[model samples]
Target: MSTELTRNFSIIAHIDHGKTTLSDRLLEFTSTISDRQKQDQLLDAMDLEREKGITIKSHPVAMKYKAKDGKTYNLNLLDTPGHVDFSYEVARSLAACEGAILMIDAAQGVEAQTMANLHLALDQNLLIIPVLNKIDLPAADVDKCKQQLEDILAIPAEDAIPASAKNGIGIEDILEAVVARVPAPVENPDKLLRATVFDSIYDAFRGVVSYVRVFSGSIRKGQRIKLFATGKTYEVKECGVFTPKMTKRDELVAGDVGYFIANMKTADEAKIGDTVTDSTHPCPEALPGYKEIQPMVFSGIYPVDSSDYEALKMAMGKLQINDAAFTFSSESSTALGFGFRCGFLGLLHMEIIQERLRREFNMDVISTYPSVIYQVTKTNGEEEIVDNPTMLPEQQVIQEIREPMVRIFIMIPGDYIGDIMALVMEKRGEVTHTETIDDMRIMLTAELPLAEILIDFNDRMKSMTRGYGSMDYEHCGYRPAKMVKMDIMIASEPVEAFSTIVHRDKAEGYGRALAIRLKDVIPQQLFVVAIQACIGGKIIASERISAMRKNVTAKCYGGDISRKRKLLEKQKKGKEKMKAFGKVNIPQDAFIKVLKSGD
Candidate 1:
């Protein structure tokens, strides 16, 4: 197809805003899938995504649509993840498109994430088409949501399309709007070949399959290509486009979206956001807006069976091919054995990776509590990054410590404003501004520590507002804070995996709560198990699990009382000896349960 006949676009929305459902409708309207093969959330592809009703990865598909204007156009659709954790993925997807379809829930109206993504689309200078989905529901207020788009985003109500993606209502109108409004890609087939790699996956039979958007020229089968970022060249074994599935093609031309298979062994060589250009006639400059993704949360992942360490590493290698945002390195703990300290975009990203390792690889793994990275400076004028609390330097040598901060945006009903303010204040947040979106709703902005809200802040906000509140946040550099390292010790030995960085004001309370909770979960051993929380050398909280008692006197009920007393003393002495020499065997589940307590 020629460049003028092609339109590249992406569908973006907040979580549960019907982005996938709308994409499914478009596929059906274009007759891309047979009626027998049609299913709800057809673009999701993964079992976890289907069950969770969320898109974990960005997907691209090409369709041929016959518009009402008697023209057949090639439409390329990119479905992006809606969660805040995957914002980086969304940004990369937008960079590959010339337009975006901004979807909003008709009943929910504009949300925190909606505004965040809208700003990203605007920054990219992409033509945005505002859409209100799920209009068939009786509760859906199309008029009110249209007003929201105007007041919050400055989008005209008439320009917004209201449709029921679930029932295929107004699907034709949306497709027609794409043809009439969205502009076509600029043709440059005569220039040097330059394609942008937006996504990729590993194939056991074919090696790495990279999804690309051709900008300046063409890529044919058997041609040599070089990656602009890595400066590595590879022979293109096969080239094709996604017909919702891989279909081999002779060549992929300019303004086309497709995949190319090269005999590349690993994902690091063909990194996302890299430029692919012809080896013989290379492009002098790479594309702009390429930035490395930084992880916001860090945790330790250990295999339940120590022998599975190698298998775990191999599994991670495969998973990383699809997810470039995740990072890990070798780390060891005396309590947990060999493991990897992994970094993630956010809490949801951390959970999804853990779940995939267990379900897809069939490996049982233990994950420690998530933490934010901190900057620590030494007395000798040296600075280091500390993701794990056990890696923190000694208190005497530390000159200063800084923790990450975020600018948080929240939207909730006016009735619950007081409760939300109280919750944010408790987390050491300061309110910066407030504005009324409508008579019944308001938006609140605050500056909060990243550590305080990385775990349970979203759950708490929903609970306080009766499931009517939504929130989104972005990293806002770092600031100095009064922090301390708190450690948990079992049987007088510190467990490095359980150590964490906490604020000094709440250290005592958090320590007491954690100690009490660990005592209940850890099984009672032959010897009494003492769980203590300490800072530096001072024990702030302690709890004890009494040893299991064996009825030593049951067999001598008819014996003399002195004889029974003698047996009791011997038992007491034996227990004391066990307590002094025996080591406690902590179970795997106990560690998981203890770490999940604070959330």
Candidate 2:
């Protein structure tokens, strides 16, 4: 196919804004999928995605569309995730495309993620075709949404196409606009082979299958290709494009998006964002926007059974094949045994990975509370990056500490502005700006510490706004903060897995609540279990679980009152001895339950 006849574009939108539905309709209109095979969210092939009704991964499909001008165009549609946690996936998809369809809900004019993605697309200088979706809904207000597009995005209401992707309304108009408005790829088949590997998947039979967008030259089967970043070379075993499924081809020319399988044993060998080039003819430098993704939240993942340690490691290795954003290092905990200190972009990302491990790998795992990375400087002028609270140095050696911060954007109803502002202030956030989107809704921008909103913030926001508020954030580097390490101890022994770094002002309250919750979850033992929260050997909060009582005087029913009292006194003496010498056995559920306190 000629480069002029190809269109590479992506559908970017907020969560539940009809991106997948729109893609399905496009596939159907172009005859990419037959009517008999049509289904809701056809691009969401994973069961988890179908069940959750959201796209978790970026899906690329090739379609042949016959435009009104009587020309058949090869259209590549990249479907991206809508959640903020997967914003990185959206960035990767945008980097591979020439244009994007910015889909907005007709009822909900503009959301936080929609604005975030729009800014990113503008930054890339990609042609954006603003689309207003879900017009069939009774609540949808097309005119209001169009005005929002005009006022906020500066895209004219006339230019924004209104359509209902569910019923195939204006599907042909979208196709024509994509062909005429979105530019074609700039072909350079004469240059050296240069392709960008946007994504990859592991196949047991074919090794690692990498998805690439050919920018310059052509690649064929049996040709040797080298990754620019890793400097590893492999012979291309097979090459294909997704006709919604892998369809083998003889060769892929410039301006093509497809997959190629090499004899790569591991997915790490061909990293995402790496450049692919012919071994004999290579480019001068790797592609742009290729950098390592740093994780923002850290947690400990341990197997329910200690024997599954090796299995857990194997499962993580397999999971890492497709998801290279998260990182893990082997860690051992006295209370939790062998585990991994895993890092994630956010809470949802962490949850999705854990759920995938359980559903796909059939591994029962326990994840501790999530925390952000901290930069700690010591009195001796040495610095360290602390991801796990237990790894923090002694308080005497610490000189200064810095915590990660994020610039959060929230869009909500005007009625809830006061409540939202109060909530932000409670989380140690400073309001940077506020603007009125319309008479009923407003947009708020605040700078908040990353640690404050890692958990429960979204839920609280939803509750405070009655589910009308939406938020998005990006890391804005770090700021100096007064922090303290809080530790949980049972029977005088510290539980490393339960340690956390907290702001100095809120440490005492958090510690008190944690101790109380631990008391409720821990069962009574032969010896009293003393749950204590401490900071630098100073006890801030404490709770006690009474020991189980034994009927030592049951045998003598009619005995004198003094005899019964004596027996009780003897039992009390025995209990004191047991409390001093015996160890308190804490159940695994206790550890899991304490982590759910939103610490």
Candidate 3:
């Protein structure tokens, strides 16, 4: 088939808006997957995605659709993730296509992420087809959704196709619109060998299997290809397209979306967003590569058993090859021993990575509380970025500490404005602006410290709005604040893992909460255990775990009262000596329990 007959596009949407379901319906309608092979989220190959009902990685498949125009066109459909943490996946998918299907839930109307994704698509200048999904449900208001599209997105209401991905309604209409509205890939006249690598995965047998879109040339078996980024060359062991499964093919020409096995042992050799060109006939210039993605949330990941440290390292290396947004470095903790300081795009991304390590590699790992990056300026005219609380300098050495800030757009029903305002204020966030999205809905723009919203802010917003709130945010640089490093001490000894950077105003409250939580989780010792939260020399909050007293007077019931008193006196003397010299053994389970609990 010629390049003009190929249509490469992606389905982009918010979480749980039926993006995967629509992909399934399209695959079924096109007869791409057989009856026996049919399943929900067919493109979602990961076990995590199936259990969570969300797309984590971008899935690409090729379909030969016979349209009403009496022509069979090749459709390359990339099913992308909807969650905000995985937005990078959607961006990578969008780079491989010329068009996008913007999916929205009819009952929920437009959302914060919906607009975020739309701007991403627009940035790439891709043709977008607005879609109103789940139209068959009783609560689905198609008219309201279309109006939201028109007013907010600026897309004409009539352009959006209304259908239920669950019931397979209007599948043909969507395909027809994609065929008519989406432009085909234009090939370079010189026909130089060039391709864009959208994603890559590691396989024990196949080496690195890269998912690529042929832009101006072709790739075939035994062809020598070079990665522009690394300047490394590899022999293409195999080249094939996905029918939801890799199928052998003779050659992949221009405008083709498929995988190529290049016998490259590691993912570093073939990086995501790298340009691929033939070794023999390279293109004059490489395609403009994607912008680098930086992680916003940081945490420490350590194995429950110290012996599994090396195994955990190997698992992290393998996992990092598949995830570009995850980062890790070797670090030692006084409390957890040796571990890796890991960085993630958000809390969900960190959680998913931990879950994958446990399930896929069978490594028992524990993660500390999540934190955001901080900018610290020292008294000697030096500046540094610190992701961990342990890396923060002393109060006298640090001239000022600046926290990462984000501009957030929250969409919610009109009734919850006051609640949202209070929640934002509590998090040390300021509402910059507000706009009425519709009669029943409003959008609030706020600037907040990234660390304040890392854990339960989203959950709280949803609860306050009766499940009608959504938020999307972007980094707005750093701002100077009165920040201090609060440490949690057990028996007057500092535990590095439990330390955090907090605002001066809320230091007492946060410290009290953490100290109380620690007291509940930490086991009692023979000596009294003092769980204290301290800011340098001063302790902001403290909790005491009373000593476990032994019954020394039980055997002297028939003896004189003075004799019983003598026994008690000796017991008290022993307790005092123990408190002076005994070491408090803090259980490993205590750290795990406290770290796992949310704020």
Candidate 4:
């Protein structure tokens, strides 16, 4: 085993609790970034994360922090995803770190998600360094937060350094604590070289760049290393350490973290939790890795033009390089023709990826309602997966279907507890446990079917809690819950392209909301639209829009029949492109709107 000389720790915090900001200060302290032009959340370089004010992905950075005792040590830091949807990613990243810096908001103390992460860290047996962040704020109550942390986390409260990461207060103290309390990384050099890949990103020129922490022995460039999970060997072309903005140093040793570039190009081959070992002297056994993440939330995405299908595929492919949770396959429909079926970690993840695809890839897409995958077993004992609600097998063919269940945790003030409980009960959620956080706050744990959360759960939770609640969930298991297939009908006829399987309790609300949203975004055409929600053969509710009763006059204004005829022809061509649903001709924009609203 390696001596504890350099510690590997990750910064785990709730959304917007200054995890990235503190990370930036750490980088500045290490001279990775210029002191004159320091930016907030340097690691959150993605435009979407910045706009959302959340960390959607985990980023790893290496820095050299000099302790107050005059000892220089290497620090490999991982900035983990703060959202509940990316909980699986956080777990994988946690496995790579020996310790974690738990950052708690001073005013908020410990949130539902903070407990969830702390529990995960405990499960992984990682040493934890607790810090109370934003303590300089007027609302900051460092003493109370430290007490709460000590009681809940069972970690020492006296060492809970209070920091205002924004102003750089207590940063040196935080570093000193990390160096003093957090043990260093493993330093077993004589053992077989073993490393755990925690994250990866694709570089167009470099192929798949894998981020790994050497746990056992040494590795150098050009060494043949076998990926234990897949038994594939690759000669390392390059190895180095990383900062938020740069990659420095080479030939990383055990207890140190670094990146390696392989000539291998595929992303799947470099899975997040896969183990890498010396091919010649392979470890007798491979490190235990996680199961392949199956996406529970799915949606259809189509290009505005048929010619852009290839571009859309490439864009999704590029995104999947870093995000292993993103699942996609080319699909076709009679109504929308050819498109892509995208699978996500959850609804939020699905929405973020879709938004990123549109905004970053510059691809206008027509998306379908997000649905969960159901189990289907054929008569001949064939197992099948049904992700698209429209493509589900006939009722008779599906012997049994199940909905995914999630273990949910919520923290809210006492005043709003009634509202939150009522909301949960309405969504078919069952309370499993509850704990009092303080006089007015409680932590509620429940097991909820994932289908119930696909809708406006976040918005509804915030509204019910008066913006004083936080919720996070992890997939528990699939349960045979009371579920139904809700068909989206257009003009009394079920549109196979617009179907979803929702919990019976939520079908009507979602159906009505979908109709309303579609009504708003569908453009006016020569014919009216009939948006109806159906369950099996019964139409629960329906809405109608009258046809385009008025359009530009056919009269030639200034002998520009070319423009007028072109306009009319364009209208006719657009009308012709729509799939006929009785008297309704739904526009592409309506499809996009309905899908976005589903999130």
Could you give candidate 3's per-residue lDDT for residues 277-370 as a string of tens digits? 9999899899888889799999999999999999999888778778888889999887899999999999889989999999999999999888
Model 3, stretches more than 4 Å misplaced?
A: 554-569
Global lDDT of each candidate: 0.90, 0.90, 0.91, 0.79
Highest-lDDT candidate:
3
TM-score of 2: 0.97
Q: Which of 1 and 4 is ahead in lDDT? A: 1
| Residue 168 miss distance in model 3 (angstroms) | 1.7
Give per-residue CA lDDT, model 1, range 258-285, as digits (tens). Answer: 9999898786786989999999899888
Q: Residue 578 in model 3: shift from native, Å?
A: 2.3
- The TM-score between candidate 1 and the true structure equals 0.96
- Model 1 shows how many backbone clashes? 0
Ten-residue segment with the worst summed lDDT in candidate 3?
262-271
Regions of candidate 2 where Cα sits further than 4 Å from its true position: 557-569, 596-599
- The digit string of per-residue lDDT tens for model 4 on 1-599 reads 23455878888888768888898888887887777767776787688888888888788887777787777777778888888888887888788888899999998888878888889888889988888999888998888888887777777888678788888898888778778877776555467888888888878888888888888877788889999767899998888887764464556677877888878677668777888899998887777787678788888888878799999988888788779889888899766779998888877787788788898889888787777777766566777777877766666556667778888889899888778888888878888898888776898899887877887887899988878899988888777755667887775556666677876777788788878876777676566567889887777767786677547654556876688878778777666565353355566656656665654
Clash pairs (backbone) in predicted model 2: none
Q: Give the residue spans of candidate 4 off by over 4 A.
A: 1-4, 376-385, 396-400, 491-493, 505-532, 543-586, 597-599
- Taking all chains together, each candidate's TM-score versus the true structure is 0.96, 0.97, 0.97, 0.87
Model 1 residue 147 CA deviation (Å) reads 2.1
